[model samples]
Target chain A: MKELYSLSAHELQKMIAVGEVDPATLLDAIFDRIGSLDKKVRAFALADKTKANDRLKRASEKKLGRLYGIPILVKDNICVKDEATTCASKILAGFRPTYDATVIRKLEDEGAVLIGKANMDEFAFGSSCETSCYGPTRNPWDLERIPGGSSGGSVAAVAADETIAALGSDTGGSIRQPASLCGVVGLKPTYGRVSRYGLIAFASSLDQIGPITKDVRDAALILNVIAGYDEMDSTSVDVPVPDYTKSLTNDVKGLRIGVPKEYFIKGLDKDIENSVKKAIDVFKKLGAKVSEVSLPHTEYAVSTYYIIAPAEASSNLARFDGVGYGFRAKESADLIDMYLKTRSEGFGDEAKRRILLGTYCLSSGYYDAYYLKALKVRTKIKEDFDKAFKDCDCIVTPTSPTAAFKIGERMDDPLSMYLSDVYTIPANMAGIPAISVPCGFTANGLPIGLQILAKAFDEGAIFRAAYAFEQNTDFHLRKPKL
Target chain B: MESIDSKTVRHVALLSRLSLSDKELEAQSRQLTSILSYISKLNEINTDAVSPTSHPLTSLKNVFRKDDLKPSLSTDDALKNAPAREGDFFRVPQVIEGK
Candidate 1:
């Protein structure tokens, strides 16, 4: 029965279909796992055991969907009808959503069971899960250390076997970074690859919701279910949703992988660098060609990201000012007082700081100087990637500079925290698909991830490359000894 | 590089509708100043004659669904989750007459 926890969602469904295992029994085993493990890790804000059981009952009565009876967790930022979609903010602390997010609707249509809302950085602001209102999520590998955020809860849940897989939003590396920290496979699909209809805004221009799972195949399977056109989101692309799972195979012969010279520069941990290099050598052994490439505007990614992301965040967050919905102060003498008091008491410190910086950047006087300049620099950075993609099938680099650090190690210094996201942020900015898979582990045994980035809407290439890597390496199979 | 100060931080906070205490203002002022200074390194790069980009893809076509009415959440369902509400409306504080 304990081995049931090790089965992938796809494998479990197949077992259920063959009548080798019962869905309700498997669901009970999953619930038992969650009940036992979730207390220490603090992954979910709410787990709907009753609702999941009821859904399982209904599933037993009828023909099941592709992912029938597969239990999944979603980031708090994604809306689910009648569930708390707080985005892990005090302002929206007890607010239940009125409708399911597009992704949730799709998940329901496909018969995937939503177990709970995972914790996250309040309003998805911080890179470390420490900023969550509930409490920090501990990495399953080492309880004292941090799980990366704002999707830390989702990643941690999947890593700790609390759930089979999860949906996470990536705004400047949220999904991939946490996935890296927690030893899970995470994908940040192209900006418009997945519909953003129900995701709470956090740097809207950069936000994308993708899957975090234990393997590349599972990630691709979830992406296939969730990726599609949605009328609710204006930015959603109307392109056809290809069968991402079907595209995954261990075939990368003659594929060109670009190794960016800038990413290999100083500041990369020697262990992480060596691990990624070894992973690339495995690709070479699998019949793929690797070449050094240049993204000349590499250094500017962090700077440009800060400006654009904040500027857009400032504008999008304007809606949360104690007006439309969410938290409100009780003793306000007037409207302005109400607005001031509610927001001040509601938002966390990091969120407050970002709103100020973003507001300043978008202010009339500084708009051209900061926001506009960052935008222009961002164009150059995208152009660099565009040029490089012409020469390579995908770009490969260390997902994070090093393995997950202790929770408070870099939080005091925001700049250092921001630098941790350098390798992954460029994909969000350029609107390309990317994934982070376990490449190796640090000497202390924390997992390191290697990122694979593909051209816009070319998730096929990413799936193919990641599957190829997983096939040649045992890194993805090593679970933390939690 | 842009200079940051306590007064500037206060002004920005007000504009952003966030009421911070004097102590928070002081701390945030210092923090924002440092972050701004670090990010100001972009000033050294010469991005002359480059166009600003808002989205990664160049095609600016707006993908829209038809204006057909689909079932939206009921008003009761929508307001069921509201922290504060009045009859048929979300209960926010008065803004117009006082202003």
Candidate 2:
């Protein structure tokens, strides 16, 4: 029998439901794996063995739901009541949320077991996980390289078989980029498709919670549970969420696939470029029609994201002031001093950098010049997608310009780090659903991701295409030698 | 376009309520200058006729919940994460200086 840790959530679910494996036995296998390998990967911020065992014991006795007894890792940014929701930032080090995020509640309702919290870029700020206070999550493919960021730890854990699957939040490709680098399947749902009621805010407009899994089927299964309308989150759309698993069909014949010209630019590594081109060819072989499409405003996506994301981050992060909850300075003389000292001492360099940049953009004299202009250009970017989608059902591109880089390689240079998200940012900007799946590997054996994007609220289209592509290729079957 | 400098960085940090050391200000000023210069590329595009979109979904309606009372966090749970608390309230440094 295959080790329980190596199986997908769906596989585990089937095994547990058939009386082949007990929930506690599976949890024990996953925890034992974490104990052995986590010292090197640094994927989890906190893994409460006692609490997890308690949940496992209780879940095994009850009637199973869709994900019965399946272990799921959650990013620290998503609140799990009474558990540490640090967001990999010192500002929230000891803070335990009073309530669970809507996604967590829904996942638990479907019988998913919460294993632990994954590490991430502090406040989900950087493209590399190095900014995390807990420490960077190393790539399972190459231990020396980074696991990509914001959701790095989530992807890393799933890739290393530390957890069956993980939930990660994406703001400017936090979920997808890491999923790409770590060689896992990641999906960023259309904005407002999943409720954000208890997700610690990074950038309200851009932030979303999605799944990082070993395969596309598991991604669809998790989405089925988390995607829905919630009255608590005003931004959540009331549109009825279809059963996502129904869309995972093997037939993608005659599906229109758009190849965006803007994504295959100069800076993209030749290996990644060739790998993505080959993935496109696989779609062609599978009977999908492929054609080139243009998104002219693509060049401005990273720049615009930098402006808008930070502007919202500055506002959302303002709630972490000393007065309410979270970290407070010990020896401040006054309120102003307290605020300054608390934030300065608590936040990491990347968080401080973004907050400062946001403040500069939204300042009295520069609001129109920076923030407003970015928003206008954002509309142009969205219009480009709108125009392209008229000709095609989905767009295919490389998830990241290159395979995972060595840790600290670009940490000193923020612009280069920001460029790591160049290909994934447009999907977030347009509020479209995008998924990253393993397509190939580099010469050094690092994973490459092929990104598939569809029109807003058209996650079904992406799933049909991704599942077809996955079935025809063995990329998703390969596991790291960890 | 205006150039960013250490002084400008200090001013922005103050506005952001984040205190930075002199060394951090100097380093961040340089980085911010480069990043801002790069982002300034947006100004080259012709956006004169385009309207700003604050959110991608413009057709959303205001969502309202029932007016009836619902369960909420108790005082202890609400203040559970506060670094300092006094009698079920958050305690902070005094704001008004004058007696």
Candidate 3:
């Protein structure tokens, strides 16, 4: 029999609803699994043993919501009432949010148990989870390697079956890259599909929240609960949300799939290239029409993303001046000194580097030359996607250039670290929905991800294609040997 | 492309309100120079006719809410996370020269 923790959220929900297992039993099995394996994974920033029990007690007496009694992990950047939402940064240490993020509220309403807060790159600033103050989350596939990050801990936990599913925010490739490396299903909804009311700001414009799960159907199920508009977030769209699970059809016959030529270029690993191409062939055999499409501005995506993300980050992070909340520096003689001391003492190296880059880009003399020019290039990048979508229903690419690299390998090399996000950042730039599903594995057994992107609010199209690809392959069924 | 030096890094760090040591400044200057050089590739593309898009979505407008009363956090909950607090206000280093 499959272990309780190994079951997907949908499977657990059905089991609980049919009275085969009680909420307490499921919770106990998960906590027990965490007790056994979390020491190797280090996937959570904070795990609350008491909270899930309280939720279980309440769930037993009621006809639970759609995610009835299922345990789920949330990325630390998202707020959960009375829980420490540190975003894996020491600056926000011991800070407990007084209210829940919109997604957390939605999860509660759907009867999902809040199991723990997963670790992340500090303030969602780095590609690898190494920048996290809590330390890096190791890849379950090989403990020597990193789980690709900022949502590294969330994806790692789900891949190891430590949780049924998780919620993570993607500002560039935080969700998809890590999900790809960790061998799980991760999705980044259209920019405005999910509300960002209480998600800690990284780059306001590119940030979005989505799910990481064992398979694509669970991703669709979680999206059904979290993807919608909320009045509190001004950027959230008012479009009516469809039941995403209905999009999980195995027959993707006659669908148009666009394989972008830009993503399969130099520096892509041969193994990853082969796996993604093989996955595309499966789509073709399923009666889907495949064609090559060009996203001409693709090379500029990393440059444009770095400029816009950090520029916005510099402005948004100015709120952490050691006044209203969080860490405060001691021995400051005046307010200005306090601001300087507090921020310098609190943030990590990568954070400071990006902040400086942002300050320089937005400075008076360089604003037009750097920030403004990048924005115009961003327009071209988005237009590239727009024109490409005119010819294809969905675009496919490898989620990362390579599988998870050894920790500390690119720690000192910032540009090489930035290049890892090359294939995944354009979707965020275009404000479109995209997903990463396990396509195949490397010879050493590290997972490779196949990314599928659709036009805005066309998550159903992404789901249909991803589901069809997943059902025909055994990649999603393979578990990491722990 | 212009090279980032220690002096420039100091200026940028001051603007960002981050204090750094000399060693940090030197190291960061080297890294930033390389990163900036890489990003300079964007300048090669002609964006003369392109209007800068600050946001991806084109349809966003100013969202307004009615001025109706709503339940909000209590003063205790609001100040719960503050590192330093006095009564109902946040306590911080004095801004003015003297009282």
TM-score for each model: 0.97, 0.99, 0.99
Please give the range of 10 consecutive residues that has the lowest summed lDDT in model 1 chain A: A55-64
Please tell me which model should have the higher lDDT, number 1 or number 3: 3
Ranking by DockQ: 3, 2, 1
Clash count, one per candidate: 0, 0, 0
TM-score of chain B of 3: 0.91
- Give the candidate number with the greatest DockQ: 3
lDDT of 1 by residue, A1-482 (tens): 53877788878878978988887777788789889988898999889889998877766666678888888999999999878788888888677777789999888788888888999988888788888889899899888888898899999999998899999999889999989888899999998879999898888779999999989889988998999878788888878989988767798899999999999877899999999999999889989889988998888888888888888877887777665567777888778888889889998888888889899999979988899889888888889999999999999999988788897897777778888888988898888989999899899999899999999899999999999999888988888876
Q: Give Cα distance to truth, residue A465, candidate 2, Å.
A: 0.7
Model 2 stretches with alpha carbons more than 4 Å out: none
* iRMSD per prediction, in order: 1.5, 1.0, 0.9
What DockQ does each prediction reach against the true complex?
Answer: 0.69, 0.84, 0.87
Q: What is the per-residue lDDT of model 2 for residues A219-278, given as tens digits with 9 covering 90 to 100?
A: 999999999989889998888889888998898898999999988899999999999999
Candidate 3 versus the native: TM-score? 0.99
Q: Which runs of model 1 end up more than 4 angstroms from their true locations?
A: B96-99
Q: lDDT of model 3 at residue A23?
A: 77
Model 3 lDDT, full chain set:
0.92
